[model samples]
Target: MSEQYEYVPHRLLRHRVRDIASGVEGELMAVVNENVSESGVEHWKELAYIRNASGREFTTAVANVVPT
Candidate 1:
């Protein structure tokens, strides 16, 4: 069996990004590590913050975006 690892979004920060799902382009502003609780289980996730040309800021999963 192969080993599995957690995904980290840090490297994607400060780069231009395009959302795979929405097709929106923007600059990656930050990657935030968040602790989430679900059904009494704790989990850590990385969220990417982005700013578009219109000056709108939004947060999304790193998997949803790619460097453009």
Candidate 2:
């Protein structure tokens, strides 16, 4: 008998910064929001509220499985 594996959707926060002087852009930060179990079940809720240096508030919600 063959075993089947299930795929679950994961979510993450990807942030990037842009340099106006050099015209360069790259990823600045990445945060994992959720983690899925071996059975492809999400065990936690992904919710984060962040504030930037510019006083900008950003909220993100993701439901995914990630390694801790």
RMSD of 2: 12.6
lDDT against true structure, model 2: 0.38
For lDDT, the strongest prediction is 1
Instruction: For candidate 2, list the clashing residue pairs, or say none.
Output: 35-65, 35-66, 36-65
Task: List, in order, the clash count of every candidate structure.
Answer: 0, 3
User: What stretches of model 2 exceed 4 Å from their correct place?
Assistant: 1-45, 62-68
State each model's C-alpha RMSD to the native: 6.5, 12.6
Q: Model 2, 6: alpha-carbon shift in Å?
A: 30
lDDT of 2 by residue, 1-68 (tens): 12232223324234554333333344323333444345665465343433345656443442221222
* Full-model lDDT for every candidate: 0.76, 0.38
My TM-score estimates for the predictions, one after another, are: 0.70, 0.23
Ten-residue segment with the worst summed lDDT in candidate 1? 1-10
